[model samples]
Target: MEASKRQETARAPALPWTVRFQIFGLVAAASVAQRLNGTVNRSFFSLVDRHVRASARPDKFGVRSDDVDVDASRGLWARVFKPSEAQSPLPVVVYFHGGGFALLSAASVPYDNMCRRFCRELGAVVLSVNYRLAPEHRYPAAYDDGVDVLGYLEKNRLQDPAVQVDLSACFVAGDSAGGNIAHHVAQRWTAAKSKSIRLAGTILVQPFFGGEERTESERRLEGVAPIVNMRRSDWSWRAFLPEGADRNHRAAHLTSENADLAEGFPPAMVVIGGFDPEKDWQRRYADLLQQKGKAVQVVEFPEAIHGFFLFPKLPDAGNLVKEIKAFMDKSKASASSA
Candidate 1:
């Protein structure tokens, strides 16, 4: 909650220099036009498209899995990752990739790296759901895909003798747009009673839940260099919704109503960026959960900006990972006790 500083040093020339350099340059460029109109968002998406395609790494961070289908109607792409250790029913995390809901896919470098880390570090099975993106798919499309996949796992495979999924310790997580999806999906799961599911928690990193106007932190950090600016946030909302859907619409804000908060809101850990325009909303949502008597852990990286969690090479990134691990550990323990 306190103001802080990021320990930024000259870009390190490291082994994965290509990936690091690309991210470094992109962040630097974004910092320059952080508040530029929609132009910066357009350029950022363009760069993301090119970078995601080129930075795809299928070999490193080895984990094993098969091409599994979650939803056929919307063409949901899924990849399962299981740890190398001999099989035990492993916890499952249904992950949604982030690209402002329109740009990147599951194969995106940052998402791929995250999926790898979750599977390897926690020894949990990860199901990365490549949900349909926006512009072509639009508002409810992403949300629908996310909920449907969770429902599918709950109904069909959670109890399947061969599934290898820890029915008692499952989770839903995503970042950015994916974080938004995780919020909605978790709500739906709780609402439906999802009898077969024993969801542990959700992880939302810098989630977007704006309703028309920017929050206090958003307004104050309007032009913070190397961070997502107000204009870019607006662009993402507009790009992800239907032609007529208003960003200010109550439905657009995940915490628009107490009813949406639901009873037994599963334990959650929401990571926010001090410089993220959406930080205030993220805090508001977490507070709402706490008010509901739900266990909520909020980790705000005061020194970092949006997407800081993606750069694992940076010192801040490494520290963020450690925080994330602690959060996950607590979540898993809470799930077991419940």
Candidate 2:
């Protein structure tokens, strides 16, 4: 009997490292290690990012892409994508890639592919910003990088004929952390007195925001979602924000106190997942925007979870693209009429 049991145990396949770590609850341990050892974490995260980014499909479908440095001194860069057949100037989408403000880049394969899809579907020139990540670059750094990218686009509008972007119809879009950055950038653009480019709209896909108080969704989905969980979300906040800063910081929480700032924001489309832990906050933000008399629309994926758009094969991904296209079309119509 003992020999039979030993043989059966030996027949079981070994689990992958990631699976093993998750099974043993070492994932959180690694996150703690990341907070303690910056170099090690950066190296590990970079390796994973490289693998993921390498999986991006080649730029086919008549979309042309070029890497451009927005700010040499600050190491700010962007990947610009435009449809090859666009004769007239195309609407500009200043896109930000999401990785909890610490992982991934604009150059990542998933992000690059996403930008290509945006260019193809919306018939718009997409400038995907490669903002610096955190633990190395903390809060307001990414936000500043976003503003600088916009400023660079405004100053160098005609630098590339192949990518002639319509600055007047500029829109901002992002998912997760990128969504949060997009919102902040739009607010800053509205407040800036010397703004040159005009914003037509903002699209936020599953924005990552948190406060000192936990929402029911967060409590229910803690350590539950396949992509993002409460613990991971909390860890990201710690790594991205200034040292010792809490969730109540304005950078994390867009509260009623600062709701007035959103008044000048352009029309916005806030997308949220029904199962996302951050859905409550995202909904609150949309409501706040509406209450402030700002034009806002909310789109909910009732059966989806966070990061659904990242997976192109998912049915929700196609639905999201269609929704965004419709919104942009409506905005364009409004702009033409005005």
Candidate 3:
């Protein structure tokens, strides 16, 4: 949490930068092709199983990555990364990781790197939540976990006086499925009139905000190596939703209402990858907010893909880290002046 430590971590040197992404892609493609006869959902899960096993970053802070289990029914687990120094009431960003809701965890290296960088660069308390996955707990479970974490932070305020977090500057963020959760949480906060916990902004990275239907990119990317396919997306939705429920359930998809996404909704910074299948949805969300007279920054990384933020070796990944830091700093400055 010291300034020096944070600086070092933020600019942490490459660990060989040696991930053989191409080989991994080839292996994944072969696996998918082999399982083509099975349900698309199950085929996708085969790749997920490999990813979960391969991505193993050791726990930092002497805290087990899965230390806090908040609820059983909702399967809420959180990993907290506290800044070394709390000079003032610093910001707190609770992040939800991507993977279509059913295929990732708070412990994944890709997300772990992001959580660390956010904590280091912004000097903010960052908590990565591992909400319940699908096929067991679907639909409302993810949204419920997000809301519960906000309440947990408010309830535990008194216990960490030294770790000063500006309640007004607290934010929730996520990528893809996680992004959907972030949006739902912000809406829930507005509905409850939760004045005790204020959010400065919400950040969505390649957020998925649509139903099973295919966009142009999704159609174009069908069976394309290293790009998301509409078929896979359809499978993910089925896994995320409860039996017999539509993926476009009003509460599940944030694009359904202008009222829930009005100007009072938190100012947002949305980062999209030009080639991501969900690019259209990201654009729509940005335009929707701007039309509503809200402050929104849409940053499109031209050469990146859906999970570019996780690919540290890629130049765009570091660029995004820089971009997010700038947004948080400016917000902090404005909050200070106000």
Best by lDDT: 2
| Selected candidate, larger TM-score, 2 vs 3 | 2
By lDDT: ranked, best first: 2, 3, 1
- The superposed Cα distance between candidate 1 and the true structure at residue 269, in angstroms, equals 0.5
> How high a TM-score does candidate 1 get?
0.80
lDDT of 2 by residue, 1-338 (tens): 97685344233223345443443443443354456433227665554454233222335588777778888888898888877655788899999998788877888777888888998998888889999888788999999999999988889883665556778889999999999999999888878844578888999999988888998777666655556777677878888888999998898888778655744579999998876879989998898887778888899987566777766656788999999999998988897898
Off by more than 4 A, model 2: 1-33, 36-40, 51-58
RMSD of each: 5.4, 8.2, 8.9
Candidate 1 Cα RMSD after full superposition onto the native fold (Å):
5.4
Question: Which candidate would rank higher by lDDT, 1 or 2?
Answer: 2
Predicted candidate 3 versus true structure: per-residue lDDT over 142-230, tens digit per residue = 88888898888888752454467777888788998898888888878767878788778888888877754556656544444243556
TM agreement with the true structure for every prediction: 0.80, 0.86, 0.80
* TM-score of candidate 2 relative to the true fold: 0.86
- What is residue 132's positional error in candidate 2, in angstroms? 1.3
lDDT of candidate 2 vs native? Answer: 0.79
The deviation in Å at residue 8 for candidate 1 is 15
